[model samples]
Target: MQNEKDIVIKELNAFLQGQYMGIRAYEHLIAKLEDPEIKKEFQSMQQDHRLHAAMVSERIQTLGGMPVNNEGLTGKIQGFISQMMMPESTENIIKMAIKGEDLYGIQLSEEIVKGDLDPESKNMVESIIDTDRRHLDYLKNLVH
Candidate 1:
């Protein structure tokens, strides 16, 4: 098994890569959304992702790893799906975005429960998870 530092660095890098991917995917989704309110919420989500991405990247560097700036494999697949699928309707767009958010939250929750992070790192992940929960709630309420 990898050591604590290695595991944390890998997790943080994965988180950063995921956030960047979400940012790009959301931007693509935002353009197709016709509702001003929905578009505005997505823009807010994009901003939050950007903030998280920066935080994770900084943490990765602090852990003696080079921060990843390019899109990772998952990001590439997501980008491809978003572009190729071409969500034609607002409902489709919401479904796609919500699905991505749900998966991200689930993955983060698992990492948090694994109990490998140092105190500061754990705190950061928890805070981000809280923000993610809020975002998911808002999206669910909006869709209903």
Candidate 2:
């Protein structure tokens, strides 16, 4: 039977994978953006994603679980294409992605914190959620 630690690790691993997907998507979106400022915001968000992944990795290790190494084929291919394409319009792309990410961040945070999860897992999720809030705020400012 899996222990509580093991169960938490599984959930953390899944969450990490989602963040990995977000990072790649943002990177792709960034590549298509033309505005230097908006590009910078995307880059900042990408850094946050990396930090979130690192936090999850730490928790996984703490729980004696091996995290997944790859972002999977679809994420890699899509990220590659997004990076390769020159964005036709910076405003639209940034706005769309920012809204999506903001919504995702809020939803994920709520789920992680309010759901029936272990204490350790909940704490980590909350921490990541805090970071996401900051990212959302930054992106919101860009819209104005």
Q: Give RMSD to native, each candidate.
A: 2.0, 3.1
Cα deviation at 41, candidate 1, in Å, is: 1.1
In order, the Cα lDDT scores of the candidates are: 0.80, 0.73
Query: 39-128, model 2: which lDDT tens digit per residue?
Result: 887898889888888888887887789986556676577557655653467666756676657765667547656655578778878878
What is candidate 1's lDDT per residue for 1-144, written digit by digit as tens? 788898888777777777778788888999899999889999999999899889978888888887789569877986887799878888888888887788865465556536677777778877887788788888888779
How does candidate 2 score on lDDT?
0.73
Task: Give the distance in Å from residue 24's predicted Cα in candidate 1 to where it truly belongs.
Answer: 1.3
Best by lDDT, which number? Answer: 1
Q: Which stretches of candidate 2 lie over 4 Å from their true place?
A: 71-87
Q: What's the number of clashes in each of the models?
A: 0, 1
